[model samples]
Target chain A: MDDRSFVAAQDFLLSSKTFWTKQIYEDLKRTYEDAVARSGKTPTTPADVAAILEGDTLYRYFAWLERHLQRLKYAGRYGLVPYHDERRSVLAPPLRDTGAELSPTLEMPSYYRRVDIHQHPGGVMSDELDGYVYERGARSTTPLMGASHADLHHRFTDLVAAQDAERVLYGRILDMGCGFGKSTQPFHEAYPDARIDAIDLSGPCLALAAHQAPSRSSPKVRFRQMNACATDYEPDSFDLVTSTMLVHELPPGEIEKLFAEAARILAPGGRMVHLDFHAIDGPFARFMHYGHGLRNNEPFMQPWAEMDIHASLSDKGFTNIKVIPFQEAEGVDLENHAAWRFPWTVIQAELKTGG
Target chain B: MRISDSLILDRPEQNFFADPALDRAFGVVMALATEVYVQRDRVRALERKLEAAGIIDRADMDREPSEDERQANAEDREAFVEGLMINLLGKQQAKGAS
Candidate 1:
């Protein structure tokens, strides 16, 4: 198609009411109803009703809405006719301060604790639903699958490559909270010599991920259920430990425990890389990000973003701790020369040998 | 509207003149809005009918719906089809002279 025709086609796809009513809207409603029915209860409260709507379904629906909003916002800037609600609900209130709270007894706000649409048996972070939601959300945001998928895959690989490059051997790589194996598959593919173990707390998502991975013929990628904060793995077992978009879902205490676990599992010279959001420097940038967390039902995101991740890593006895801005499309940029990409960073730390 | 000899209306042209992305976004938004409006109207109508039938107390039923309850009922499939016409017609007008 010519440029004009292509643009026209794109416009039609975006604005066409029939497209949504006949396809996405209908399909989503059907899926929601089926899921609710499968759960076998008519919930009286919004929270209970939300629980019945599988996390994947909620994730997919929100993913769809988010993309639409992105397009609308993009279009609005150029006066191309804005589409979505410019004024929507803001993010929820910050967690009540419980100073010096050392335990994992921190109670998540009701909104944050509510079950996601993906029916993520627990919540967004711990289950296979995370993988499904992330994959579906990522794919929905970008339709051209090959390059987008490859870019993310390669970025993940580079993270692994940075750790075990000298030896040319990756003994075992553990991907904690390996949602749908999107971040996990790359480790296996990057180091074919290594065994990749993906862990999460959600059984349904794990089952789905297991089924999806082999169908795509990924090698040596295994999915299992285990909390990231407390895994059953032996100490110093994994040569490399990694997690993607996992840490933010956890509260402060859980996050500390997770780092401790990663530190425990890493052999000498072994590295821990966690792909997540970082506190963007400056006040205005910080405000925009915190606002995003509140409006998106991401209760812990703001706290996670504000926490000194580098300090956390260091406190856990990990050396060479650094919060490097990670360009998801292009791996870690040591020189830091990219512009106009989503704000994301990876916390890269190495477990100190003995003391 | 009289029924003529059975005619298939060429699957009403799917293309919207707007940007494909915009079309998709608007389509979903409009559909959702329409769905919400229709559902709201249906529930109101049902409540009215129930009141007329003496099934529910009119004064209690006449109270404005809670936002959360409205959201649930609006998206509820059981209450949706009854509300379809309002959304479909409303969307046509919102689409402009296309």
Candidate 2:
């Protein structure tokens, strides 16, 4: 497809997604409330809500749109996957000379191999230009996040930069699962003097990450292919360890290991901050989010939410742990916003230095 | 084989809708959504053509769109979604008046 048609198709998907989020979601929420009232049960769990409303027409339509809209976004006639496939030559490059390490032989964990993880044709790891594909597909990930998408990353960086200066200071950072460097870009920009080592399981994504980086950046990010669960780095290697939107892609067990690895690598008095989806607004939202996991091929989102990061962090002997709702936009994160949105939250914990 | 034809059926989300009518209706709505934006783009392109032909001045092109223009755009979108919603969901339910 020509550029005009391709962009038009993506814009259509974005508008359709906005309609689903703004209009259809409200209708579905009402249907859930009515169904729960009929069943005489105010749902306390997502399962309870699902049991009550999953069979309703509105809920089913919501589910169908939730699934197919994403598929349509990535795999439809002018979808990102095929579009990027055609532009593979434009996107593919040699990572070896770029100073980024590529592991051609790392055994992809079974959990990563099992699911497509975002309705992408192949998950982010498979195709050579899949990183470029992900970067494009991300443009429409949340329709509400249209032009202000860049601002969300900047807002998150502001939150991290606002960390209490007296508590923990950082000179070196590790960004886990930094796909295509989108999550890592702002950090490099914000703390240009601080060294950043970004690792992802996908070589394709790391290659793109390095390619996208500005060549002369001070403390330029070193992109490496490595599993977040078990990195080769020694303990106390990083003053700050972080990941964004990655924990939800992992099973609870892997998430546990990831936390252990981050904690192990974090210097004493160092912090770990992650921006991820959590803080589901209500029971209806919970029902939809869990069902979204089922429909979108992300098997672990609901389970990750259920894992309770605060408890896990506390168990690892971390101090000052907090899971707070992140304001992605000025007013959108408030509870009263009628549109459907990811329950963005910041989970932060600090390793303590004790006498 | 076309890349689009490759199997997406591994997950239940691929083809879970049981009713053919609803499924086809979804396809129609999505296609319509795509065309709606396409038309808007065409309109903008024509406006740009007018500016190129010196019909609409460069200053006018540089200026922000009027409130009237913004309202018209919003109304067009509202009408389109309202009609499309009514098509997918019958008028009674789609009206959604409390």
Error of 2 at A124 (Å): 0.3
Highest TM-score, which number?
Answer: 2
Chain B TM-score of predicted candidate 1 relative to the true chain B: 0.41
| TM-score per candidate, chains pooled | 0.52, 0.83
- Candidate 1 ranges with C-alpha deviation above 4 Å: A1-134, A141-150, A166-169, A215-219, A330-341, B1-29, B32-98
For residue A342, model 1's alpha carbon misses the true position, in angstroms, by 3.5
Q: Estimate, for each residue in B1-98, the C-alpha lDDT of model 2 and write its tens digit.
A: 15455634554324435776777788778767776777788778878899889898857767999999889799888998988677775446445548
lDDT of 1 by residue, A1-355 (tens): 1223223333433333234333554465556557668878655543553454325543344344533343322232211111111111211111112111112343333443563322222344432223343443344233322246556656767865875567475678888877565776667666776777888765534555665664235456667667778777888788788888788777777788999998887887788888887836543334435544543335567788868877888888899888877666535343442221234677888888872
Worst 10 residues of 1 chain B by lDDT: B1-10
Q: Model 2, DockQ value?
A: 0.22
lDDT of each: 0.55, 0.81
TM-score (chain A only) of candidate 1: 0.62
